[model samples]
Target: MYFSTSTLLLAALAPAAIIASPVDADLTPEGVPKITSISFSGNGCADPGSAKTSATVLDGTLSTSFSTFKGDSSSNCQIHLQASGAGAGWQVALKEATYHADVTLKPSTSLSFFTTSFWSQDASVTATLKSRIDCAGSDIKDSVTVKQSTATPVWSQCTGDAGYPGILNVNFRPAVTGNEGAYNVKSASIKFEWRKC
Candidate 1:
């Protein structure tokens, strides 16, 4: 079995009145925000070298591939990301996320995928997405999307911890039960929205 995952971060800046000056060090040539650092943990990435980021900060794109990621019974991975270039008085929020996967399940077998995303400062403002498949046979493709509420968006810390990057933690779990099955996650992407404090 072969499993690979990649993450792409996209940002949309709010109105000019809400956004301050851009942080030169955190922006790419096109003025887009960049992911400065990313770390992975959990049983899915037990091998130190199995997971790696392929894109650089200058690319304004961050991608990770897992050479040995597969789900037979259960597998989980946690990803922590810190981004820069939102400006001095602005903060980031997770607007949406989409995950794609390919799975194969025998009769009476089922697979479930669950994801939880939240900012480090406040866990109350969190978003989650769950998907389940039952006896889907071989070569089944799946995709799930989770969107946050716009009326009451959860913003990152803006004042108390000034200069600290807005942090987002995402955890993904794939579980299988009943008979036997195979699951492989293809990719996942996150979209960010920025606003002033």
Candidate 2:
């Protein structure tokens, strides 16, 4: 009876063990990071067709810039934890991904890749932010484009093998005028974890 019960418990725990990896361990070639929640530290708002500037999209050094949207600067430019889609999310600590954390990534374990998206309520409107993580800590350079769909934000990302770790930062580069859709930069942020095989 005891042996049978032990076998059943081990079988039940097998899936979780396979799914969960040690934070500092190397990731499988196909393993991917599991994110239960996300957090945004800075908030900056800007209206369309305007030359607005914000520093929230920056890292600790406050380097990244925004020159598109024009909105109340005071209203935005703040940082805090917010929900991804639903208010009740996983953990802000993991979401508030600072460069400090990325820099401290396990040296030879796994790599981390990040991406973002843009969302809008108006179908006729569009916006985008491109992240330049080329200089970030990683085994190789990775780039991600955050685009705003019809009132919704969607994202796509890619990464290299081995392990990438370092400071991850993104920038929002606006396109020329007379574009099809008119949109503003609503938000800019980042989250990171190991990209398993």
Q: TM-scores of all models?
A: 0.64, 0.20
Q: Cα lDDT for residue 120, model 1? A: 81
The sequence of per-residue lDDT tens digits that candidate 1 reaches over residues 35-128 is 6778888898778877676654423333456656677888877788876654466566554444455566677787766666778878777765
How well does candidate 2 score on lDDT at residue 182?
Answer: 19
Best by lDDT: 1
> After superposition, which runs of candidate 1 have C-alpha atoms over 4 Å from their true positions?
1-32, 55-62, 136-154, 159-165
CA lDDT, every model vs. true structure: 0.57, 0.24
Q: Where is model 1 poorest over a 10-residue stretch in terms of lDDT?
A: 7-16
lDDT (Cα, tens digit) per residue for candidate 2, span 99-147? 1111111112222222222322222322222221221233321122232
For candidate 1, the per-residue lDDT at 181 reads 79
Q: Local error of candidate 2 at 99, Å?
A: 21
Question: Global CA lDDT of candidate 2, please?
Answer: 0.24
Worst 10-residue lDDT window for candidate 2 reads 6-15
Query: Cα miss at 58, model 2 (Å)?
Result: 14
* Number of residue pairs clashing in candidate 2, backbone atoms closer than 3 angstroms, sequence gap of 3 or more or interchain: 23
Task: Estimate the lDDT of model 1.
Answer: 0.57
Which candidate number has the best TM-score?
1
